[model samples]
Target: MAYLFLFGAIVAEVIGAISTRFSEGFTRVLPTVVAVVGVVGAYFLLSRALRAGMGIGVAYAIWAALGVCAVALVGVLFLGESLTGVQAAGVALVIGGVACLELGGQH
Candidate 1:
């Protein structure tokens, strides 16, 4: 399904982003390789989703929003990063905006 492909893309994108953090400016070999592979896979899956009839606006919005939120959470939980209250609110706003986009797309 298109949704499934989109989900895979989002997950791959998140993994790529997190691995980028571990790549240490690409000085680390394994993480850098993983980051590159994951990103490439993400694009591949995203294309599949689009080819499967997912609208680009909706798919890209969901992918970007969810990937950002997931990466932020991973950073806080596993990477010793801190999120401020304002940042948390911003995340909520992003989710809300995506929800609105999805709702608006259902003509």
Candidate 2:
């Protein structure tokens, strides 16, 4: 299904982002490879979702929003990063915007 492919793309994007952090400016070999591979897979899966009839506006909005949120969470939880109140609010806004996009598409 299109949604499934979108979900895969989201997950792959998250993995890519996390690996990018670990890649240390691409100085690290394994993480660098993983980052590149994950990102490539994400685009591939995203294309599949689009071919499966997901609108580009909706799919891209959801992918970008969720990927950003997931990367932020991973940074906080595993990478010892902090999320400021303002950043949290920004994340909420991003989610709200994605919800709006999905809702608007329904009409």
- What C-alpha lDDT do the candidate models reach, one value each? 0.96, 0.97
TM-score of each: 0.97, 0.97
lDDT for each residue of candidate 2 in 3-102, tens digit (9 for 90 to 100):
9999999999999989998899999999999999999999999999999999999999999999999999999998899999999999999999999999
> Model 1 residue 14 lDDT?
93
lDDT of 1 by residue, 8-61 (tens): 999999999999988999999999999999999999999999999999999999
Q: In model 2, which residue pairs have backbone atoms overlapping below 3 Å?
A: none
Candidate 2, which ten residues in sequence have the lowest lDDT sum?
13-22
